[model samples]
Target: MKKIITKELVPGMVLADAVLTPKSNILFEKGTILTQKDIAKLTFYSIDEVLVHDNEIGEIMTISSLPDGQITASERIKQTKEFQIFKADFEKCAEKFKNEISDLVAGNKEFDYKRLLAPIYELLQKGQTNSAVFEMLNNLRNYDDATYTHCINVALASNILAQWLRWSKEEIETATLSGLFHDIGKLAIPEDIITKPGKLTSSEYSIVKTHPQKGFDVLKNVTISIHVKNAALMHHERCDGTGYPGGLKAPQIDRYAKLVSITDVYDAMTSARYYRAPLCPFIAISMFEEDLQKYDTEMMLCFLENIVNTYMLNTVLLNTGEVGEIVFINRNYLSRPTIKIKNDYIDLSKCPGVYIQEIL
Candidate 1:
C-alpha cells in the first residue's frame, strides 16, 4: 500500500485502510473502492493522505501509459509515498554521511557503521523490489541534489547486487558500508574541481586521481573492516591491472572492493550532471558490456545479466525518436533488448545502430 496525499487521489483507487474523521469516526471503510465523490469528501474533510492498495495506485502506474502515450516507470514510482519517504530519508542520510566524512577527515568522530546502515534498512522496509528501487533512484537523480547522493546510490545498488550474488548477510552489510565510504577521500579534494562543469585539464584530472590513496590514508587509521578500507583504496583497480593508485590486478584486489567497483561505475556513469542528462541504464550496461575486461569478469557478467533483465516490459525511448517496450533481453548482447513498438518488434542487436536513449 502507498500513502499518498488526498490531492493525488483519483477515483477507482481502493483504500487499503479506513479513512477517519479527526475525532476518529469512520468516514470510509477499508477496501472501499473510491469514487470522485469519495475523493471530494476526503478533500472536504482535509484528510491529508490515505493508504491505497499497491495494485490500485495509478492502476500499477508503470503498466499504464498516460494520455500522451508516455509510460515512465520512474515517474510512476515518484508518485508513491514510498518514493517520497525514500527521497527524504536519502537526503538525510547524505547530509549525515557527509558530516560524518568531514568529522572523519578531522579525526574527531568515531565511525558509527550501524547508525549509517539504519536509513538504508528503513528504505528496504518499504518493500520495493530491486528493480523498483532502481527506478526510484533514477527518478531522484536530479542535478540539484546534494553530491553526497552518489554515495547513497552506490551503497543501495551495491547492497542489491550483493544480495543478488548471494553474499552472506555479514558480507552484504560490509559491502554496503564499503560503498558508502568508498569515495570519502573526495572530501579532501577542492570543491571547484569536484563540481567543475567542463572537462578537467590533465593536471586537474591527475589531482582527482589522488583521491583513492587519500581515501586509503584516512581509512587505514580507523578500526573499520579491512574490506571497507580496501574498497576505499582499490574500487578503481581493474582486473587487467590498468587501474590506478595500485594498478592491482583482480587477484590482488580485495573481493569486496571488486563488487563495489561495478556499482561505483554504474552510478557514476548514469548519474545526472551539469552538462548532460543521466544516461539510460541500457546505455550504461552497454558500456559495461563493452569493457568487461576492466572489472571482475564474474561479477561484471552477473551484474550485466541481472540489470538487463530488470528492464523487461519497461517502456523505453529509442535514439531514433520512437518509443517501445522491452519485451526480451538478448542473451548474446545483454544491453540490446528486443523492443516492441505497437505490432512491430525490433531486435536491437540486429539493428546495429539503434539504442535506447532513455527509460520512459
Candidate 2:
C-alpha cells in the first residue's frame, strides 16, 4: 500500500484502511471503492494522507481474494509486535529523560534541551501525522506515573495544536518545548505526594500547586527562550484568574503558556492517576467545552477538532453497552456522533442519553 495526500484521492481508488470521522466513526471501510462523497468527507476531516493499494495507482500486482473476517493471525501478531517495539522505545526514552530531569533538580543545572527535545522532534518529523503519536498516547494512558512519557505526550500535543492553528513552524517548536518544561518543577516535589493514592490534605495540595513556580525557577536560567521559561511558570494559571502562584488572568498569561496549559490538563486528565482511573477523551472534551472560558477558546477548539478526528474509525463501547464504529460527526455537536453498530446506524444527536464510553 502507498500513502497519498487527501487531494490525490480520486473516485475508484480502493482504500487500504478505513477512513474515520472525528468522532471515531468509520466513514469508509478498507477495500471500499472511493467516491466523490468519500473524498469530500476526507477533506472535511482534514486527513493528511491515507494508505491505498499500489494497484489502485496503476502498479500491477497479484491481489489477495481471501475473505475478510477478523484480522488474520499473522496480521494480529505483526500489530502486537509493532506495539511492543513502540512501547519499549518510548519507555527507554522516558527513562533517559527521568535521569536528566533528576540531575536538573539536584544540581540546579542547565537543561539539555537538545538531548531532551531530540526524540520528540524526530518522532514528529518521522511520523508526520497524528496517527502514530495518538496510538502511543492511548497506550500510555494505561500506565501510571510515567512523568517523562507524559511530558513527551504533552509536547507532541502542543505541537499538533499549534500546527492546527496554522502557527509558524518556529512557533510550534517553541510550544512543543514549552510543554516539555512545563512540569519540570514536579521533579522537586516529594514522590509520596506526587504519587499519593488518596486525596491530599490542603497542605499537600498546596505543595503540589507550587510546581509551576518551582518549574519556572529551574528553567528561568536555562539557555532557552523567555516564552519557554514563562510557560513553565504560568501553565497552571487560569484565564479567569483562578490558578496558582501568580493567579495571572488571561491577558497576563503568555501565549506559549496558554498553549501548554491546555495540553497539560489534557494529558493529566487522560492519564491514569493513583487517585482515579483515566477519563475517556470524550469526557475530557466535555470538560473543555464546559470550561471553555478557562482556556484560550480558539486553541481549545482547534485541539478538540483535531484530537477527536484522530479516533476516527476506532472501535468504541457505547453507554448503552453496544459496540460500534463512529460513522458521522455533527460539527455543531462534536461530542455526540452517529455510530454504526453492525447494520444499525445510531445518530447520537437524535438519541439522548446515548454516549461514547470508551475507545477500544
Candidate 3:
C-alpha cells in the first residue's frame, strides 16, 4: 500500500484503509477504487493524503450480480402488478393532462385547476413519496422527449419538493400547476422547431426562449395564483441572473418559481433528449452541485439531500462496476453515498474514482 498525497492520486487505485473527514468521520473505506469525482470530494473536505494499493483493478471491471432474479433491479420493479397498474394510470392521466393543457392554452374556458392536477394526483396515489415515483419513472420509460410527459414529470417532482418543504395544500396546488404549464408557451413554437433533431439555429433558439413570456401571458389574464404566473414567466430565471426572458436574481424571483426552476432542470436532465440518453440520477446530482451558484442554494441543497436519502437501502451499481446496496448518505456528497458490497461497507465519499453509475 502507498500513502499518496491527495492532490497527486490518480484514478483506479484502491483504498488501502478507510479515509476520514477532518472530524474523523469515515469518508472512504478500504477496497474502494479511486475515481476523479472521489478525488474532488477529497479536495472539498480538505483531506491531504490517502492510503492506496499500488496495482490497479486493470481494465476496470464491472461487477453485476443479479443471479437470483436473472434481471436488473429496474426490470424487476417493472414486472410487478403495481407497476402495470401504475403504467396504465400514468398513460391515461398523461393523455388527459395533454388535453387539459391544450384547452388551457387555447382559452376554451376556465378549466378546472383540479383537472389539471389529476395526472399528478393519479401518480401520487401509487406511491407514498416522491422517491417511489422517481423509482417507477426512472425505470419505466418510452416517452423520454414528449412535451406532455415532461410537464407531468415536472409537476410530480414539484409537488414532491413542495411536500418536502411542508408547504400547505393550496401552496402545493400552485406548485403543481406552475410545473404543469411552465412550458405552455412552447405550444406556440412550431412543432417543427420544438421537435427538431438537429442543433437549433440562433433564431430558432430565440423563438424557443419566448416560451416563458408566452406562458406568463396566457396565465396572466387567467385567475391562477400570482405565484403560478410568475413560475410560468420565471422558471428559467437563475439565482445568479443568467436566465432568459428576464435577467432576474434570487430576490427578484418568485419563491415558487425557484422551486419549479430546480425541478424543471432536473426532470429535463434525467429525461432523454433527442441528442443524448437520460442521465443517471447521480449524474444529475453532480451537475446540480457544479451549478450550485445558479440556483436557490438552500432549496437546491434540500432537494439534493432528500433525493439522495430516498436511495437508502437501494442496490446501486458503481462506476467501477461493483454492485452494492446504498447504506448511508454523506450530507456533503449527495451523489457519493456509502454502499454495502458483499460483506463490507464502502463510504463512496472517500473513494475518489467511484460513484453510483445506476440505481439498480
Best model number under lDDT: 3
lDDT of 3: 0.81
Q: Across residues 175-237, which tens digit of lDDT does each residue of candidate 3 receive?
A: 898888888889877989999876567899899999999888888878778998999899999
| Candidate 2: tens digits of C-alpha lDDT, residues 112-167 | 67788787776665554666666566665665566677887888888888888999
Candidates sorted on lDDT, descending: 3, 1, 2
What lDDT is reached at residue 98 by model 2? 82
On residues 1-360, what C-alpha lDDT tens digit does candidate 1 reach at each position? 899877677767999999998879999999987754466557545577899998664322122333586546776778889889888887787878887778888875477778778887777666478877777787888886344788888989889889889999998899998988898888888989988865577899899899988888888878789999999999989989978888999899999889999999888767765544566788778767867888988888888888888788988877666778999988889889999999999999999767786777
Native-to-model Cα distance after best TM-score fit, residue 85 in candidate 2, in Å: 2.9
Count of backbone clashes, every candidate in sequence: 1, 4, 9
Per-model C-alpha lDDT, please? 0.80, 0.75, 0.81
